[model samples]
Target: MQRDALSLSQYIVYRNGVPAGARGGLRNMFHRAFGAATFAGFWRHWNPIFGYVLGRYIYSPLQRVVPRPLALILTFVVCGAVHDLVTMAVRGAPAFFFVPWFVLLGTGVVLGRAVGLDLSGRPWVARAAANLAYVLACLAITLAGECFIW
Candidate 1:
């Protein structure tokens, strides 16, 4: 598999069109993520820093060994596990929120791609709304699972 040669700073600039510490960087990140036309595109735009590491360190290696769909889901699971670790450390208790949350998001991306979901030609507002809705729906499901199941 080909590796991304861009350094972290370069990746951020390339993805966000601005330097990491530049004013409006956060705004740009949100605009790009929410403005994306698909759920996968949203993940692509969400956090250039985390995405870079996850892509290079986690997803790429898994992709080499597993099927793409399974790799994608496992990547999210690993990412969420890291987040949960931090949450558990900070709260001094076990945390289970992010794993299922990220799993749903990953599944959404897989299903969206399988269905050929694309909103690139739609109006920007419409695209943003759809992307936001997908994210919120995943969060809602995760919250419900946490309350009822976990």
Candidate 2:
């Protein structure tokens, strides 16, 4: 299934669900590929491996070992850092990209715990609502920070 991309910027503007930012296809592809490659490098450095051993041995069971919420938070934090680093490399504004993305990830984790996946295996509607709320809350926090800080 094709998943919709969440728009961190839109969430702040709408005070509703996350919105997708407009981007050229090529640019979006490059950004996604760069982000993926960076994160892959980080993953390899953190947990070195290769081949079927990598997927089956290293990754598969790792998720089961940790609580879902903790894992989600950690993964998003790492992803945010990867995205921030890529943005810095491409745009030369490291701190600006880094701070917002890092904060966004942290916000996502807190929101997830507070809403998304927190309900006890409820209906799909409930889960989706929670996730939507989580995204909105994160954006709100980001906007608040931007307003007060700069």
Model 1: residues >4 Å from true position, as ranges?
Answer: 1-3
Per-residue error at 7 for model 2, in Å? 30
**lDDT per residue as tens, model 1, 1-150:** 133888888888877889898998899999999888888888987898999999999998899999999999999999999999999999999899999999999999999999999999998899899998998999999998878874
Score residue 81 of candidate 2 by CA lDDT: 65
Candidate 2 residue lDDT tens string, 1-150? 111132334322222122234344334333332232222322222211221233343334455788655554455555556666887888887444445644564545455446533343555455445545554666677677777877
Q: Model 2 off-target regions past 4 Å?
A: 1-75, 95-117
Give the TM-score (vs. native) of candidate 1.
0.95
Q: Tell me, what's the RMSD of every candidate?
A: 1.6, 13.2
Q: For model 2, how big is the CA root-mean-square deviation?
A: 13.2
Pick the lDDT winner. 1
